[model samples]
Target: MILFCPPGVYRAQSDTELLAGRLARHAAGRDVLDLGTGTGALALAAWREGAASVTAVDLSRRCVAATRLNCLLHGAPARVHRGDLFEPVATRRFGMIVANPPYVPSETSVLPRHTPGRSWDAGPDGRAVLDRVCDGAADHLEPGGVVLIVHSQVCGPEATVERLERTGLTADVVERARIPFGPVMRSRANLLERRGLIEPGDRLEELVVVEGRRG
Candidate 1:
C-alpha cells in the first residue's frame, strides 16, 4: 500500500488496509471507525467510499496528528484520536468498523531501522493485536455491522474464525495476500506457532487475512 501525504506528517502503510479497501462495502452516510488509522488511509478510503462519518484512532500522537492533517487534505470530517483499541470511542458505536491493527508478533518483530508509523508489530505470534481486536469486536459493532481486517495466513484464518465465533461473530477470509517473512520481522518459528501451520516441529513461510463480523 502507498502512503500518500506531505513530508512533515509521519505516515505508515499496511497491506491490511489495501485489502480492507477492497473488502469494505460501507455505503455513504454510514458511521465507520477506522482503527489504528496511522495515516488515516482507511479512514480516507472509507470517506471516499461514501461513509457519512468516519472516526479514526491511533495510539501514537504522531499518527493522530498525521490523520488529522490527512483528513483535512481530503476534506473528510474524520475525528482522529490517540488511544488504545476503543478507549477514545467508548461512548460511540458504528455501523461499520475497519482496522489493520498491529498483528505482528513481538518475538519476531524487529523494529524497523526507520520506522515511519506506529501500528506494525505482528505481535508475539503475529496475532497479539489481531486477537485483542477480535475479542472486543462484538461489543462495538452495531446490529448488522461488519468488521473488515487484514491479517496473515501466519495468523491462521481458521483459528481466527473460531475465536470470533465464540463471541457470536461470523468470520470469513475476505481477501488473502502473501510476502516472504525473510525481509521484515524474523522468527519463522513464532509465526508458525501462531498459525499452527507447522507440524509440531516444522518451519513457516506465508501470511493471510481473516475477516469477521458480528452475527
Candidate 2:
C-alpha cells in the first residue's frame, strides 16, 4: 500500500512487517487495535485481512495525520487517534491488539520528547512503553482477545511474557527475527555491550513478537 510518510512519522520497518504478518492470521473478521501505528501499516494490514474495524493510536500528531491519510488513500476503515498508548481508547476493547512499540534501550531513563527518537527510544531498559502495553493489555481486551507486541530481545522478552501472564493472560513469544543492527541499535552497540545486554562483538539483534491471550 502507498503511504504518505512525512519527515516526523516513522517509516515501516522489519518489526512492523513481522507484527503485521502475525496480525493477518488472527485479525480477520475481528475488531482490531493497532497501538503506535506508525504510517498505519499494521492497521492497513489488519483491514486487508478482513478485520471488521481497526483503530490506530499514536503519541505523535504527525503519525495520527499520516495514518489518517493512509487510511483515506487505501480506503481502509481505520480510525486514527493521537494520544499515549491506550489513553485514547480508554473505554473501548477489541478482539485483537497489535503494537511495534519503541524498544531500543537508550542511555537515559527518560523517554524522548521529540521526533524520531520518540518513535524508537524506550529509556534505559527499553521497557518504558513495552511494560505499559503489557500491563494494560488485559483491561483493554475483550474475552478471548489477544494482544501481539513486537520488540527486541535485548529488551527482555521473558519479562514481557511474565508481565502479561501476571495480568491473567497466557503469553508467549510467537515469532522471532534476527536482523543486523539498524542505525539506532548500531549506535548503541557499545553501550549495550557494556551493560551486558549484548555481547562485545554481537552485531545482530533478535526481535521477538509476544502474544498474550485473555481467557
Candidate 3:
C-alpha cells in the first residue's frame, strides 16, 4: 500500500517488517495501539489484519500527520494522535500494543529534540524509550493482551525482557533477523564499536521481536 511518508518520519525498514509479520498473529478481532508509529505502517497492518480498532501514537507531528495521511489514503480506519510514547492514549487500553521504537544506541544521552535523529537515536545503551515502554505497557493492555516491540540485539534484548517481566508481563524473544547495517547503522559503525555495542569490523546486527503477554 502507498503511504504518505514525509521527511523525518521513519519509513518501514527491516525492524518494522519483522514486527509486522508477528503482528499478523495477534491483531485480528482486537483493539491495537501502535506506539511510536512512523508512517503508520504498523497501524495500517493491524487494520488490514482485521483489528477491531486501531490507534496510532507518535511524538513527532510529522509522524502523526504521515500516519493520518497513510490511513486516509488507504481508506483504513484509525485514530492518530501526536504525543510522546503512550501519553496520547493514556486512558485507553488495547488487546495488542505494537511498537518499532528507536533503539540504535547513540553518542548522546539526551533524545534528539530536533533533527531526523529522533527516529532512531536511543540513548547510549539504547533503552531510553524501550525501558519506558516496558514499564508502562502492563497498565494499558486488556486481559490476555500482548505487547510487541522490535529492536536491535545491540540494545540488549535481555534487558528489555527483564524489564517487561518486571511489569508483570511474561516476555520473550519471539522472532529474530540478522541484517546488514542500514544507512544509519553504517554511518554510526564507528560509534557503535567505540561504545562496545558491536565487535570491530562487524557489519551485521541482529534484530529481535520481543513479545510480552499479560495473563
Return whichever of 1 and 3 wins on TM-score. Answer: 3
In the range 116-167, model 3's lDDT, one tens digit per residue, is 9999999998889989999999999999999999999999999999999998
Clashing pairs in 3: none
Q: C-alpha displacement of 82 in model 1, angstroms?
A: 0.9
lDDT of each residue in 64-143, candidate 2, tens digit only: 99999999999987889989999999999999999999999998988886768999999999998999999999999999
- Give residue 195's lDDT in candidate 3 (0 to 100): 84
lDDT of each: 0.69, 0.93, 0.93
What TM-score would every model get versus the actual structure? Answer: 0.79, 0.98, 0.98
The regions of model 1 sitting more than 4 angstroms off are 1-14, 108-118, 180-182, 186-207
